[model samples]
Target chain A: MSQILRREAIYALTGLVTVLMLLEYFFWPTAQPWAETIRTWAIIVFNISLGLGAIRLLMQQSMNVQKRRENWQYSAMLLSLFVVMLLTGFAGYFATGLQTSNGIYNWLFINIYTPLGATLYPITGFYIFSAAYRAFRARNVDAALMLIAGCFVMLKNAPVGEAIWIGFATIGNWFQFTGQIPGMRTFSIVGALGLIAYGFRALMGKERGFYAGGE
Target chain B: MWDVIGLWIGWLLMLMIYSYPLYKENPAFRTAEHMFIGVTLAISIITNFSNVMRMCVTPLMQGNILMIVPLVLGLMIFSMLIPEYQWVSRYPIGLLVGTGFGLGIRGTIKPNLQDAIIDTITAPTSGGAMAWFNFLYVAVGLICSIMYFMLTFEHKGPLQGPTRIGRLFIMVGLGGYFGNTVLFRFTMLTGRAQFFLQVLKLIPM
Candidate 1:
């Protein structure tokens, strides 16, 4: 009985929400406000869901520390920092009656968070160069053509490349303008169609892999 | 005063964390990794709490009783914590998925499909030699790339030629993407290097 109810609720909710959204798009006169409300509700629910992740993190880290697991000291450090950051953020908001943009919270974000986040992408630079050296070998016709194109584009971007030969910039521009844009557009259109088909399946509840008990 | 010091400290910490994988993994790297994850999660939680309070809680408290429906649905997600009630969480997940599909499908159909087709068909065809070449190139690229994706028909006889040409065009397209990615990474490296050099007084701003 419970299983049947659960399945029914899932199908009904999905169908109702999807139909409401389609109505809003196709027949905007009636369903506008309701569709807007549903969107707002989704956002609210998404915000609430963020706590689920924090809760999971807390539980796992606490367990690690309690059991004296390998690298438990790191887990303890994580928990300590987590609590400190959370407290500082909440205290800043409550004390100032403003968002986290002011006080100690902002300071922590600018100094610690922003710097740490920024380093992530730049670090990828080293990996890209390492990979290019290994992969960009001109062993065949196709690979040679691609390597030549990549080298031209890379040189055209760098100051030293232009200083070495002005023609590199001209050829690079020609390749990008004449070749890349149309190909990219074709790929984008195809990708978008795939997304639409996937979305349709999800709306119809045919894509049930996201559900708890789903295959 | 303190902000400048903090910025420098942050930069140093970032460099230290990033340098770890280059060398062997050690305790210092592990400690930094843990701190980074914990701090990031804490910030995320605080931001979400603020958004919920401002958007949902405040409005509901101010007499928007209809907001209760979504609030309850949001709360239903917590049912996943209890083994017996986990299936109930599917309701909200279903609603989210449906809403996302509806939003995405409507938005994608017009710009990605309709506009793209119109743009390709009506692209300027009459001009100088270079202009004509570009027009033909784009047209051929579009048609051949589209044909390459046609899975219904097997490539044989006359169709084999176009399919092979289409594959080459696709390869060229992929090559362009690879080149662009390399340029982006190089640019990022240059920016970070410039900052570090400035800090060390090796170069002027």
Candidate 2:
């Protein structure tokens, strides 16, 4: 019974939903509202799945603290923050606690969350710049062209390049946008074809790598 | 006063993150990283949980019978926590995957496939001889780039010339993307530097 649910039933449900959507998209215009509703249900389902990661993190951190693993203090700190954040978050769940300027949740988000998130890209920029030396090496014709293009872009951005020659910025703009449009268009078409192919495979039960196990 | 406090806190956090490269691995960075993780995960879980309450449970309570299906499906997902009933989660997963792919294909079909082809073939020709030349050039480039993706037929003999042209287009496209990425990183670094300078009173807002 369980085997049937996991294998055949799962695939059947997927195919039905996919067919419903595709039909709404192409054939059954009247099914638009139904399709949208189904899409909403799917989003809700995916969001619920999001909690699984937090559950896993809580479990792992709890174990680390219990076992007194190396740097277990850090694990304890994480667990505390996780629990505290959850409490603060839920405190604001039913009220104006999350968004109101006077609320603790909003305060924590601004001071902690916003700063932490914003720092990510700027910090990562350092490592990328360090790695850029190796990456920009002209090992082949493709590498050389890419390097030249990167240089032009950088030149266009910097005032020094324009001071040397005004055409540097113009050439860079042409290379970055006009030169890449046709190729980008072609890529988009190919990517869409691939997506349609994958959707077909799912409909045919050929794409079973997702949720095909546990049977 | 609150804004000043937030600014100081943000400046300190930014300093902690930026110090990582200078010190290799440090306590400050690890603390920040772990705290970020915990807070981020908490935020995500809480947001999703609230969404569930708003979208599913509340609707079911208010007499929307259809909400029960997703509610049940979502509850079943937690069964994966138990070993024996882990198989039960596959139903919701299947539904999610199906909906995702269906949406993906549906979304891409018109914009990426249909309109893309239409745009390429019906290129605007109002900008004189240069416009005509560009249109023809793009048409050829697009055809060649597409031919590069056709792997079933070998790119030898008759297919060699177009195949090479396709490769060049691919490289140029890749180069443009690479350049844009580097420029983005540069902007980000500069922004961080500016923040530091502002905090030090070396620059004005």
Candidate 3:
């Protein structure tokens, strides 16, 4: 196609697709059959994506093993665990007869995955403490204020602050409830708008990054 | 039984990789990093597709032609993948943006502006000093945060005080961010450790 023709086709396609999506969003049919059909296609694509992920995991593990990398052992372990999980999950589905018992997949997910996932958040305490020690310097007026506010909030988050200064607890609560929360909300709203705009530009084929020849 | 032993060994191996980052950048660490990124991306794709098919695609396919809207919009996202046909992504992007803006405006107008304004105006003093401090916090925090965004003009005689207050609020905000980062990092460390501990002992199970 000619340059102008390509551009026109792209724009027209994007515009048409956009209209369809907007229409669908506003006037979603209240019928169950339509919902089910949509659900099937979504699952098929998602499953294909999952299979791709498993392949990626296997590839990385193989690479690590070949290179004899130090953490190669870990990579191997990850692949093994993933395979086991995948197998057990599939097996359990097929052998639905033994579904009542503590199936292999269920046990592993609850005991292993659940704890590991939950710990991800709580484990940040060390990094936070170390980072604070390194970066909490009051190099400027703004930095100083940040340090003070951060300290206050940190203290207030825990019971120790209340023990040290009764006012700290209340102050922390007020800062979060009044200041921090509202500020973050505004930032999120503005950030989301920017994200949507960028997403649109990308989808319209306006995004040069997606092009094989980088613009 | 074999799986159990393998899981324990895997946990140990993962912990070792996690520790490599604290020491120095090494092949082991890099390998672990690559593996993590690859696995996570893959899983996310799978889960999302599973959910979309279950919730969206299947419904439309089974005589629910109306459900074609989001699917087509979503597929339009792939126009970005087609190099020559990439401009098709714009349609979905536009739809996403329009809906996002609508939802955001609807959600934000009342809570962010209206409620905040009302709270600022209705200062309370029922709890003595504590209440006074809270009232001041609301007043100052609102004004200062807003003032910080005022870049249209330079701060001069009258604007100096508000500008200074804005700077102060900003500092406070930065501090909060620092604290959060520190907390997050520590959490990562704890997570690695917990993984090791859980594998070493069956108690966590």
Candidate 4:
């Protein structure tokens, strides 16, 4: 009974919703409202999943702090900050909607969160350069081609490359559109096919690990 | 006063984040990582909480019987906390998966597949000879790349050459991608640098 309710019933639900959604789009346009309602409910459920994640994190962090695990101090720090921000955000949300432009939540988000994000993102510039240094080594034909192409593109990006010669920009632009477009397009085509296949599998309830959390 | 304090804290935190590459794994870096995650999750939690309240909870409170379904489903997610009731969480997951997959499959049909096929076929169009050449090049590249992804066939005789050409296209594509990414990273660095300079009064705001 337990297995039937959890696995078979869940599969049925999944198949039903998927069929309804596809039908709404392809065959029965009148089912659009029902489809939209399901979509909205899915989104709401997804949002609620975030809370589930928080609860999991809270449990893990509390356990870590309790057991004095490695980097437990960091876990403690995370919990404190999480609680602080959680309270402030919830408190400010009723006062100001979405916490975008103005509010205590936005203030914290902008000043503290924004700076951390900004700095961390740009720091990748350094790492990429380091990566380029290693990866650009032309040990073979493929590597050499990529290196040559990469150099031209990098040169085109820099002001001095176009200043010295317009050919750099031309070649760079050529590589970007001609080289990238076909490969990317093919990838997307293959990817879309794969997505449909996955969707089909889910509809059939053959793919079990996704909904059951690897059970 | 609060604004000024916030600015200073932000700048200091920015400096701490920047310290990661310079100093390696350290307390400051870990602190920033923890703080960033904590605040981010908090934001997500708050936004979702607000959404649930506004969309479902409030409606249900006001006698909207339909809202009860979602509200109950949302609460059911809390079953994940108990090992015995963990399977109960599958209900919401199933709904989410169904809608997501259904919409995804629906979206791909005309937009991704049909349009892409159209572009492939109509690529060699009535333009200058150079335009024709470019289109031909992309068309061939597209075919070759797709051929490379064919799993059933062994790349032994005739298939090997096209697959090789496909790999070359992919390499060139990666190179171009790398260049674009580098340009982006440089742009990001420049913005951060400008921000730093402005904060220090070395440049005009």
DockQ winner: 4
Candidate 1 structure quality by residue, lDDT tens digits, B1-205: 9877886877686677766757867776677678788889889988888888889888999999988978898888888888889887887787788888787778888898898888777757577798777777877878887777777788787778777677666766766778889888877778777867776678985
Which DockQ value does candidate 3 get?
0.21
- Regions of model 3 farther than 4 Å from truth: A1-127, A162-215, B180-195, B202-205
Restricting to chain A, the TM-score for each candidate equals 0.88, 0.89, 0.70, 0.88
Best by TM-score: 4
Shift in Å, residue A96, candidate 3: 8.1
TM-score list, all predictions: 0.91, 0.92, 0.66, 0.93
| Predicted candidate 2 versus true structure: per-residue lDDT over B1-205, tens digit per residue | 8767877887888878777886777888888878888888888888788778888888989999999888788778888888788778888898898888878888998899888888778867598886777778778888998999988899998898898788777777777777778778878878878877887779995
How would the candidate models be sorted by DockQ, starting from the highest? 4, 2, 1, 3
Q: Name the weakest run of 10 consecutive residues (lDDT summed) in model 3 chain B.
A: B97-106
lDDT of 2 by residue, A85-197 (tens): 77878877766534223266667678888888878667767777778876778888867776777778777777787889999988887776666667778889889988888
Which regions of candidate 1 are displaced past 4 Å? A99-102, B152-159, B201-205
Q: Show the lowest summed lDDT stretch of 10 residues, model 2 chain A.
A: A94-103
